[model samples]
Target: MDRSLDQLRRRLLIHCTPSQAHTAAEIATAHDTGLVVTGASADTIAHRLREKGFDGPILCDADRYSGPRRVDGGRGIRPAWCRRQQELGLVPLTDSGYLEPDNWNALRSILRVAALQRRPVIAMLPLAARWFAESHAVDDLARELDSYGVAVAVAIEHASDPFSVQYVVRHFLRLLRTAQVPVLLLRSDVAALGALCHGAFAAATGTTSSLRHIYPLTSKGIPRAAFPAVFIRHLLSYHRLDTCETVFARTPETSHFWLCDCVVCGGTTPDRLHDSDDQYSVALRHSLHAQLLLHDEIFRHTDTPDQRASAWHEACSHALFVHRQVAEHVPDWRTPAHLKSWHTVTDDPLRGRAGIPAQPTQRSVLFERPAEKWSAHERRGV
Candidate 1:
């Protein structure tokens, strides 16, 4: 997949969990999207890429050396694992530390370990924004990342709130301009998505390639929504921001929304992860459709530049029309009693462990800076 970058116009990144490499490889083949191998034991997962016919680059995780999930409390993001990925020739990516300032130091230590093993594609794990944009410290850190001579990608969030969609898009584009670090923006609102695309489409006349979208998508879970999320990629194409459908491959979870009767849907009646008739199925469909369609509406309904200047106007109309159809066809469902009770019972075991505490306030930070930064450094590069 040397030409993989040319194929994926939108640059899809699929989240692979529960099942890792093999499943990701399967998605790569089906959706023809890029692979981002998340979860622990990423080196092991990466080995499955070629066998599954995935030609695009793989995004290996920082899980093995010393995250909370490490077995035997093994040092997370192991040097050996990173070495293994280098040996296999996979592209690498590390999360930007979040929830606090010092998290960068902690993540930087992990990156140093990988550097010792000669890993490529080193990225900075910046803090995730709750209500504001990336701070000066964050920008300074990105500049430091640039100094390291490696590619940098920063993480940001788009939550389920009223301003979530526009806030992410606007601020993210702004960040890309200020920091020079590649930005990954998450979209969640269909109309806001259309509005964003329309805005970008208008701005695109003077923009360069660096200003285009670099969407790395994942699901809350495989959605059995009204339409397959692939439709979202199509909208991205209209502005040329989401381009290159010829090179990269995406993870299989990309086919999630088109449940049942589809090959990837796992056909067995009882095996259906969310059988259409299951009580959770209706809500499942909504949850799945809600976010993915935001992307889909942009691609499917957003008009091409040649069609008319009222592209966004038409896209909004189409999104509303499709939304109405989804409401009519998909059943009204609620969160299941068992799952809700589990949440109430566990009362959040994950909180303290991941450095998140009960009643977490902004004061409780998830990461602390590393005491040291260098094993010794010359320079690094992509």
Candidate 2:
């Protein structure tokens, strides 16, 4: 709580499970941001980090996926275990419960305790929640939560459809930004880019598909498939070309699809992404690099609306161009049709608004965009 919210500006924090604590720490060190350890095993992760000689700020998140009634409504107090961890020097964050409009009272109860303890509260608002989908409901929710002074973490629950995910992210950003709260987008890599463009403090996605994509807390775990692909931040999608042969044959050489100059993948082609025995590690590193790069690019523009609008425009155009390239080059690529929503926003920025088009337009511009084509090599100055 002592840290100023402004410190989150242009920063990227990696969210991980207990098992991924070491990798998360490395990513934090590489990106120069704090780490957020979540899941039922977070306490174990905190202990492991301490044992491993990690000396940095660690946010211990209580997993709220068990049952809403257990911890909702003042019945769910901060566990003694979490309190002990906090005393041991880990910052405590609430488990991200699937909060709906009706659950405001429960959230209020949780925030009250955190405020009393002077803890920096992390509120996870699921986009699928009815309250979050409506502007008026969101406005009311923001007004209520603003009193507690907590940071917002958005979770998009298991949205496989690209357009639905992007729409939810954009709408949530627009509504939440009104509260002027420091927002962190959870999962959804493409939406995270859009969040930053709209002035979110930070955004997070996991190293694996399970980590990168958000699913319902109640859903059963699905088996993961090994797909070696490069995450194209500009396009807000992944290119699933596992082997060098696949990449070379599937994508045009003239297209910059195979290029990346991140320290993890420097001078490497997209096909090399599958060369690693640990494809998970490779994907995580690349995802982190893409996020940090996008954050830096958007951060370069000041907090002014006009500058943000320009940045949004530039990002959307690049994403559209890249999407076009992919569709033309790889006819079979499953590009989400909703990807065009970014262009629509770019064209009107104020598509749904009815006004003189002066102040509102500035605010609306932030929610637009789908992807970009900027090569990591070009962006990294390689």
Candidate 3:
């Protein structure tokens, strides 16, 4: 790998929409962070970033997997767009078809195109959940991808259920173990951190929920909320601004868990997150910084793969404990199902072998809420 790609390892690639590009550039200028933008905004965003003095690596998502017809939408892959990507200093992604259980032809065609290009090109493979449930398909795909010697970007369709995502993650790790090529997990949320822990070359999460995952476009447009969700690191999930305020208001003493000390937050607590014309920008910067802090913690643990996995598992377990403790006080703040699913998978003994795991655990923890029992400094340590 070259110096630019090398810098991407163990780092969170912030996926920015056209509107968020300026903020991301400001943040990227200070940190060794890579920015991902769609092909539509690639040239403009890259130009703006360069003008703003950010010369780091920029990735352009071809975004060809959403529709069936290649030329149906302007966002789909085209020769002109690919050339534009090259001009903007990006490793062009092929206009690969979305991969389903029976879509071996599409996968093979992408690899063949990568070989013909004779340059470093990322083969973006948008997968369906069925790819994970079918082990034979995953093995075949991984073998073919490894032989091509081209970097791969894997994007899964939106899945509301954790089981659906778990399948994708398990198969993703299998590919990482088998393939020598770099693999990137795109359009993710908290799952991005889990991917980095288990050896993903890079992972991306959007500033808003809609961009966080790949959703099939419907005739009926999905409505986006006025204010984006706030990322609470302690809970390992995103919550609405109103939800955060409610949690803090109900259990004022326990607000320490959600308070952020990142550069964006300074000394301000999450309880003060309210809707304003500028609240979205504040949430976006805070979310990005909070994720960076957690990513740093994971990367700082210089140990073997098993040890890293153990550390991540411990963090998830502690987050779950915090969730339960908060629920004990705030009735409406129940733990999200995906959080429980993440902890369960990390706790499996087989997690060491595959780097990711399946199977669920029924274990439960009973602990007294620590707000009253611990000092402010001690509580911060938790």
Candidate 4:
């Protein structure tokens, strides 16, 4: 229940949907992972997780931004609801609507409302990938965010395309460099690892694809995929379990590279991932554990920015090579664009090599609290 700033920093926050609550709770018993729940299920889910031995930081996200074109109808998110979330021993959030290029006024209103909370509130800034990464007003947005002096987490909604994924990582690194405040990446899957290596304080990803990326919602309903994909840790991306099964079935010799030795898998082969009724849950757990492993690798070299960037760069380079080996066997399978994009972004010589001080330390980016000052609220779980 000691949710201090030090406890929150350098953690791979797992965003759990209602369905993923129990599985996440089970994992919480062993791993030092943070839990992020939606506003509707914050209190009940937090209590459930606590009963199951999840003693890490719990954050409530105000799920107001569904897509770039969608706007809050003014009824879904209320200030009183946010205050109630804070009162429930969970970190509250600002009800920020999706911001476009011309929606600076809306951002101002969101910040103003967050300022009224009188506590540490996470301000959500959701925007289209291109607008967030390629727009000229990125510095303006950063200035406004710094001026407000609040913890802001940004999500690049609907960044399924390759170009957007490439720039989103670049833009996140740029914002983290220029912004005076903490710039946390939210709802990112593998991109979260890149953000942390480039000097982000915190990053989050969802258990399922629907929770991982933000897409447009329709009047009919939100589109949900039928099955969870397998997370190939060496490749740093998710692949279809069926596809993995085929690959292992066709080319059994390559099984050595794709097999997972995590506690959930216990050295199980990739083809056996779909062998049980709880296949979806298995895949979800494997993905979470794989991501946490990647996060640990990046944080292991946090002593210097060069070492951190070099560590991630080496991972990406090896992933790309593995993709080539996989393609030679499974001719139909191709490497995901984001993997290539991440490698390319880090390949820049100026990224983590030059013009940066050696003594400041990446530890400075984290928000640390004195143990004595936060002792009173430790029992409250905030």
Candidate 5:
């Protein structure tokens, strides 16, 4: 590894599927950026990047959802993946994506393995996606992480699941109080991203997108031919809290990713990509390109005071133009015949104004009406 385990730094992880790793690496190499490749398979792609000269960090994903040990833990892919990542000089990005009765046990096991390798963890999700209910050992570990001052990031994957967001929100509050860590709430859905940026929940933020996945809005009005950079501006500005990051989909170059200019793929007259192909090659390419644009923009702009205040508006305007031109189709992931077109609503009293009116006003802040169980939690921890 080029860097050391000296201190914990706030990291921005760009999820690179195995297929897009090469293009992602190309972009990263150009900008001197890194990749957060998920899964054991991700390493194969990361290695290729090194051969091609990528000069950023590579975080091998530790998606140990079922917690540390399964009935056949040794046979699991994660443990071996960790060792392989170390071999390739890659870092570890851990998350508890699995839902289990004893999530803490899995995390502890993962942590134990990580500590042995001296693999510095950038951040972690101690709760389930779209929910905050923690596993058995999560609270205690949160304290441990706090004492060590590790930078923590919580993933709010999908609250739209048949689940609750209350637990996730509550758990995040505890993290805010107990840890002096940067909290990254990942909500890529445009609407959800807007909501997170709207309310008091905007303390710290990060976002992802499917724009490059199945559906991509045209770049007619957006920047880099993708999501309105204003989306990012809104996310960064929504909260008095600063420091915003996003994973955008779309490259400034032709529509295709992987440097592959398949006529039906990335360009205006791209070929028809098959849905059965899990790799989502075109989506992958567009996503990498978009992210490359944003990543460099973020590093150059957000770090500077003047540029952040000045360049933000221009950036948003660019994103909006791109988003307007891209298609609103999300195949398989969304229900068929779904309507995502931009709507213009008039002042009709019978039904609600279901269109994008003038900019939305701020939402009201609601307190945690749930009884104070932290005292009980604290007492038990004590």
Candidate 6:
């Protein structure tokens, strides 16, 4: 096992489909990361990338979404299909369909096939499986997967609440620490920041609203109306209103207060996000830029575990400060309800320890100094 894979710092992977291949290629040219191509059109995407001369590392996923039933009835395309994808110089991943506690047999079969074919697999462990499993069970499962040497990708099937999301991520990180393998948090969105802070290898989100938002397990993709929205870099949250007019009407002062420094929206007002003819592309570009910035910021202080914990603690403090700012400045601006819970749970002194006590109001000042200036006071027992 590569020791670097186990020591997660900050890595971002953009998730896309064949329809967004051109956009993905564009982003890949700018960012220093790979892309995870999902959906039933994996083959098409592979071919498109080849024709477009995209030579970046590409990890192909078989499952599009989690659901009650497997996307393809627990049986992905035939071995021939996998062979064809590999022939195109794309890494073929096993279709570890919607992982659940009761479906270990199905997951085992997927891993077995991947091992037989001598391919490194990407396993999707559902949120429920992590939440319901005991610590020993999680540890044992991680140990069992070490033999296959596959990269684990977590699918948060149900994280509607902030506290639950933080707890689940903490649990998953603990489990992955034992696995000693590369891990990816899939469809993590803003929560990807938390995953990076907790030492996951990589985190991914989509280009559009439907792709960014986590929904219940479904065989079919849900169609959602897209609106122009700005991703607040400091708070690590998205602010979406009914329309551009509404966003402008509500956030003129707030926009001036918290300007985005990302290249995509630098020096421009937040309301200008909707001014682009291609709003989705603009939003995606902003998001990708913001993610890379956050990753770099976290990576700067990751020399040791203590240093990393201090940096993460500072980040949590900054997130809390921004959360409070959003509440005060943009009362009409809606943020994820789970954002507060995530802040609360991560700030707990006894987090990841047994018998977690009642959440307390975090009093740590926001991180404003340079990364090198962080000291013992910021470590927070992490």
Give TM per candidate.
0.46, 0.76, 0.83, 0.83, 0.47, 0.76
Lowest summed lDDT across 10 adjacent residues in model 3 is found at: 362-371
lDDT at position 189, candidate 6: 70
What TM-score quantifies how close candidate 3 is to the native fold? 0.83
Residue-by-residue lDDT tens digits, candidate 5, 183-226: 44332222222222222122111123322111112333222323
Against the correct fold, how does model 4 do in TM-score? 0.83
Q: lDDT of all the models against the reference? A: 0.34, 0.57, 0.66, 0.66, 0.36, 0.56
What overall lDDT, based on C-alpha atoms, would model 5 receive against the true structure?
Answer: 0.36
Give the alpha carbon lDDT tens digit for every residue of 186-300 in model 6: 6657666666666667777666554554456555555455565656555566665244345445544444434544555554444466656666666666666666666655565
lDDT of 4 by residue, 1-382 (tens): 2254346666778888766776665554445668777546666777777677677777766567774345653322357756766666666666576765556677777776776775666677776665555645677778888888877777776735322366766666778888887777777787777777777777777787766777755575556667668788767788778877876677556556665555555556554757756677667776776677556545644567666776677667777887887788887777888878778776634355343223221112211211222222222221
Superposed by TM-score, candidate 4 places the C-alpha of residue 47 at a distance from the truth, in angstroms, of 3.4
User: Which residue runs of candidate 4 sit more than 4 Å off their true CA positions?
Assistant: 1-3, 67-70, 73-77, 159-164, 217-223, 250-253, 348-382
- Alpha-carbon shift of residue 266 in model 6 (angstroms): 2.9
Question: Judged by lDDT relative to the true structure, which candidate is superior, 2 or 4?
Answer: 4
Candidate 6: where is the Cα deviation over 4 Å? 1-10, 64-78, 124-133, 159-164, 217-226, 241-257, 332-337, 347-382
Better of 4 and 6 by TM-score: 4
After superposition, the stretches of candidate 1 with alpha carbons farther than 4 Å from their true spots are 1-9, 18-24, 63-78, 95-99, 102-104, 107-119, 124-126, 130-142, 156-167, 181-382
Deviation in angstroms for 373 in model 6? 34
For 1-382, candidate 1 gives per-residue lDDT tens digits of: 2232223233334444425345344434443345555555655767766665567656564432222322221122445544566677765554323323345556556445544545344443433443234355545655654545444444332222222344333444444445542333222223223323422211100011111221212344222224212222212211110111211122222222222222222221112322243323222222222223333333444344222214333433333333343334334522222222222222222222222112112222212212222211101100
Which model, 1 or 3, shows the larger lDDT? 3
